[model samples]
Target: MKILVTGANGFLGRNLVEQLRNQGYDELLLCDRNTSESELEQFSQEAEFVYHLAGVNRPKKETEFIKGNTEFTEKLLHLLNENPNNPAVMFASSVQAELSNPYGESKKKAESFVQAYGEKNQTPVAIYRFPNLFGKWCKPNYNSVIATFCHNIARDIPVQVNNTETELTVAYIDDVVKELISLLEKSSFNETSVLYEITPTYKVKLGELVNLINTFKESRNDLSVPQLNQNLTKKMYSTYLSYLPEDDFSYDLTMHVDDRGSFTEFIRTPDRGQLSVNISKPGIVKGNHWHHTKNEKFLVVSGQGVIRFRKIGSDNIIEYFVSERKLEVVDIPVGYTHNIENLGESNMVTLMWVNEPFDSQHPDTYYTEV
Candidate 1:
């Protein structure tokens, strides 16, 4: 089906477009200030539905919010009214619109326009009020609390949080997109206008949300530096933890700390690939075995370690000292024996990206005397 999506480049809009495309809707017209009027007109002519998502979401001044949100909706409605077909339109409102704040007020005004248009005209309109949205493709700015926490943790920085145990609901981007697609595909709402609230059913505590983010960071073998600033105002603290950029890395293996001093590994499997392990704690050592069909690759995420390797035909030993701020990608040929030991006080973590899936059978692993 032909569809038009505004604010196409924005975080949620981008995800919605992807989901639509994946569902076999490719005849999409994307409209934003970035597109020309001619482009919009062309899109309007071709689309059977329009997902109205464009607006001035964050205004430095209060008046701009009215213009960006309310006025923009009016302009789009006028265009739709002028068209012969008057295709169905879905308006993306926000939970804030029903509550307080200039941003919410503006959205409510836009929503009113959409509701009135749907009642007066032949076209159908669906309004979806969204809550906090998170996941990949999240932008760095514009008040994203989840992104902020993820960014701080990735950088090993402490995530500041308010002491309040207030409940916050979040909607994963993928799920939101899926719901939008389902609404578009179903004809049940055609007989009348519809308004729906979208959010994950479960509510998470503010502190628990921060901890979940920290867990994900640590699981990925990433560094976390947490700082608690008790002196800042609550509002300032909230704003500070809402727009952090994510860290992207390529690695072959990830080491995570478990209940005790023991470590768990997230190893990426690749045939004939090399894996590197960086030891953060002195005297800690890793695997002392060789794989038959499992080739591996490794790089140190942080700290220092020593790699020892041996071959069946050779009696000689080879060792390499890996240090922080250094990246070493190693390739272990099949049946090659190796082990790693840490040489520092801090715990070592490694980033790993692999091409194969894990398998327990025909393990392709054999141990040798150290």
Candidate 2:
């Protein structure tokens, strides 16, 4: 099917067009500002589906809003009328259309033209009144506060929140794209004028949104990442990473080094515990201590080592020789004193996962010989 996407270089249009291509739709006639009026006329004649996404969101003059939005929409729908295909339309309206502002007024007018065209042609018209949209490729400091926050917060740039309690509704770009594509399966339209809402929209306070995004940067140092299982946090986290400056993509991981090689904390979780990398010098013995409640799993990633364990009042010593040559994990159980000795000529690297983050106040650790 031939599809025509207006504002093809725009944030929503680019995302929607790319997803359509990914789903095996290649006959897409993308019309941007640079595309000639004749090209759009030709595309309008052939397109079976139309994504009316072009609009003047922020204009210097209020009149430009009408010309870019309402007037342009009328011209395209008129061209669509000259064709016999009667292409269905998915109009990208904003929730702002509910307001009395000039931009909103223009969008509301454009929605009417789209509704009339759909009725005249007997085709489905999907008027999506989207809330603030945010994801990759959205211009920072333009329309989306989430995009601005993610971009600025990722770079340590200051973000001002006049009212911390101000709540805003936002929709992820991927979610919007998926929902628009799913409309293709919808063949029935009970009426000509229908308002469509994007499902799974998220609500976030200004302060909370900033705080959550800040944790993404702090995760590198504290290793305390956001709860990604939560859909909103997961989506915001992905959007935050995409706006990171190319040169600042990588950050330094703090490493604690002494005579016994170096130890670096990789990741930490509230309920799942922490992962750390331990490097031991040749002949170095580490972890001559046992935890009362914190259990751990140790896997040797390099060199050779022997992890020895002894129960607190038992004389029996259990030992497991490990090396990178063969992969295996040795679980350190509670109430047992354990130690790992680097028995190789080179440094031994061990990856460790503990059941909890380290607490200096209530460190369940007690030094003992194993």
Candidate 3:
């Protein structure tokens, strides 16, 4: 399927693109400010679906918001109108778009533009109003609470709770992407407007979230005993002081490094995508064979390694010398013989993004050169 994605580099955009690509949609048109009008038009002609995510979010001024959110969206809708065969369009409208904030106001205006365009063209517009979204690629300094909490906890600092009683809903990035793709493939929108509230299955209290951070911190520090404090005000104050760091705490949490040079990590699903672990000792290789059905993307997470890959029926041998200084992602296509070895003093970790789920029985994998 030919698909176009805006804000392709942003957090949500990246996740969505990855999902689309994994589903075998390779003819993807990724657009952003860096993308030109010519490029957009070229893709618009070929794409069967357009996922509009590019816009100004959390602008400092109202004018900035109007230009980023409203004007930009109108421009894209105009582009869609010009296309003779209008492809299905999915607009990423924020829950804030329906609420009252400079960001929300701008998004609301953009939503109106989408609705008007859809009605005029007699096309179906799928609008997803997302609540607070948090996952990988999320930066700490942003308004996202998950990033803030992760940042504070990674540095052994306490998180601040603005509203103790307020409950917020969070949907994992995978779930959100799945829902979007489902809607796109289904294309069952009968009405002019198809709105869905995107959120996690459950809601979490703000104060309780803070406590969870503290619990995680304690577990990480290997603290066996729990500190008991009766005074609510004093407890909050103490937690805040104990966890706050000395330096710039607002830095991107994803890039935060420990003494060992490990950044904050995320859980990986083997079937869904790739996850890499470091091999401390040399000569350690995870897979020495080839998977017939598994297509994988491998990137050195840290240290150095020597990767050897050869496809069957080819006498040629290819080798890559990878290091921490050079961030190179090697795509291990299906039915290829490959092996990797750590070549540095430090451990070698590689993140692997796979196209399909891991299966042991019908692994579609075969050993070569034993």
**Leading candidate by lDDT:** 2
Writing each residue's lDDT as its tens digit, candidate 2 over 196-259 gives 8888899999999999998898887788878878999999999999999999888788899998
TM-scores for the candidates:
0.61, 0.92, 0.58
For each of the candidates, the C-alpha root-mean-square deviation to the true structure, in angstroms, is 12.2, 2.2, 16.1
Query: Model-by-model lDDT, in order?
Result: 0.69, 0.92, 0.70
TM-score of 3: 0.58
Tens digit of per-residue lDDT, candidate 1, span 6-109: 99998888888888887788888888778887777777777778898887767788999888799978877877776666778888898888788999999999
Query: Model 3, 53-98: lDDT tens per residue?
Result: 8877766767998898888888888888877767778888887876
Query: TM-score winner among the candidates?
Result: 2
lDDT of 3 at 5: 95
What's each prediction's clash count?
Answer: 25, 0, 8
Residue 270 of model 2 has an lDDT of 90
- Selected candidate, larger lDDT, 1 vs 3: 3
In candidate 1, stretches whose alpha carbon ends up further than 4 angstroms from where it belongs are 186-193, 220-248, 251-370
Clashes of 1: 25
